[model samples]
Target: MPNRWLCLLLLPACISAVTLDCKHIRIDKKDFDLSALGGPKTIHQQRWLPPSISNTTFTIDLCNPLKKLKGIDSKEQCPSGTRVCGIEERYNPIDGVKEVTEVRPIAGEFSTSHGRAMDPEVTRLKESSNADQEGLRIELRGGKFPETRQGDLQKAIIELHCDAELTGNEGFEDDEAAVDVAGYGSMSKRAKDDKDDEDEDEPELPDLDKGKSLQFVSYKNEKDDVGVLRLTWKTKYACENAEKAPAKEPGNKSSGWGFFTWFFVVSFLLIAAYIIFGSWLNYTRYGARGMDLIPHSDMIRDLPYIAKEWVGGVADRMKSGGSRGGYSAV
Candidate 1:
């Protein structure tokens, strides 16, 4: 399970190396004048301008119609380049006068209404400023929403930077040291493989045979719920000082290395526990059962007597046992 998750995680880090598309992060904070008695830092929402779209304008006309009403012929849509086209009526053949009636055009056929993005899942990350420190930079990917023309502009559009923690448990293919931005762990669907079981009786458990596993994580102070900027990110200012840089320690190496260091610390504790626990079992079960006959080989071997009878002994008392807490022992 860990292996699959590791692969999934490593895939991104690997790609990041080939192409570092991380956007520039700016933590906008106001520095109080020395005269002002120690003011704390504050985060202000900033509206980011999208990159320009070459050979295109933000202003596009609404769809124009094919036919106009007799009385409404003088009226036109709000913006130019709007088009709305539909089929007009055709007259039916009649015997007497053979008169033809005009068909009217409807609006739905070809029309353009200002459309907004749907399902914009905005994610945020902590980024650094000119100085490398903890900050947030939102990352957006293509989803159900339409691909935004890089030049869409809006008034008072504020970015809500998220603070969810993410982690990567993956390894590198070429044994190169991976850059782990954060220690905190992080963040999709499937189709039916079995044709027979369209209607399942029991709930299908997630397939773990391939080593894929789900990561549990959480966040706080979510400003909004609906959508965030598409193809854009919101990075927060560094909580710590942007200047007065700290140095990275040389002792720590790779993520896997950290695991062994910590894992061994736990393993050694468990081993000591087993040794002490096994000694206690041996002394309790057959401390003096047959000392002379018992060989040292059987007493303290690598594999302790695993049988429940030896370890989980029977508790019994020599007769007259009903007398309030009689001499009963293990």
Candidate 2:
């Protein structure tokens, strides 16, 4: 009897365990910014721009179209099981199609509007920044309203924040480092095998895997009564600096030494060879010894003496022509 009663009590829990169909909700990478000081950080269908502890506003844009709102076309409704959370439409005023800022939920079903309604989730949940606390702590809280009408849907968005601490490595890469939020699991997709372009001169980045994983944090369907989803991530600026390549030490010699050393050495050898060859030639011609062979042997040992005697004779014979600058050619 006790076992049967236990099974009967557990029947409702088993039946209500259907996973919330949140495959449609997607995070917009562009709307998310870690640099804001104290503004609406998360982006949702409804606009909420003020009254936050920090000026930073991380936005999550529901790229998925809405389904069941009061004034919207039925063709625009979200999937059947999902209820209406927020309506994002442009008001066609006389000026033109201006963006509607007012938060609109399913009419006559829920009174709450805007994103601040998520404060309760933040209050209920507690999260710490990374161990280093490298940046501002952005908290997230979310849940769903009871299904007053059939197919009532709950809308949720994720927020990422970096604290006042700024790591200079920010903006180094297009993709931000994956964040590991406590109790929230990892905020990045699992890695897959894809070729990386090593030719690009990109700086070292965190070893986060990039894959086509669904960008959701968590979701819970409350016994077909309400559905809740929550997601949080740290700002890219909060990531730790990647290890930089070590500085190269200067070489012992200058860059040109290899060519210059070989050139000088070869030049010296050639010059020594030329002198030795000339000396040998002079020795073979005149049979002179020692330094006499350095200059042409004929010029040093024979020509100077012969020229002196010849010049003395010529001077005596051609004094008159010499004085007139017309010496005889003989």
lDDT of each: 0.25, 0.35
- Give lDDT tens digits, candidate 2, residues 1-330: 999999989966653332221221112221222222121122222221211001111123222222334665554333232222332333221222233232323211121332222221121112343443432222222323333345444544343344234322232233321122221122112111111433423222223223211123544454454444444443343332322211221222334558778999999999889889988888999897887778664566777789999999998877665465656567
Residue-level lDDT tens digits of model 1 in 1-330: 999999988976654432212222233442111111011111111111111001100111011112333443232211221111111111111111111121111111111233321111112223333233233332221111111453222211112232222111111112211111121011001112222445523323222111111111221112433122221112222222323212222333434557778899999998778766655666777583443223353654534655544445533443445677755566
Worst window of 10 by summed lDDT in candidate 2? 49-58
lDDT of 1: 0.25
Q: For model 1, what is the error of residue 81's alpha carbon versus the real structure, in angstroms, after optimal superposition?
A: 41
249, model 2: CA deviation in Å? 39
RMSD in angstroms, all models?
A: 27.0, 31.6
List runs of model 1 lying over 4 Å from the truth.
1-14, 17-139, 145-330
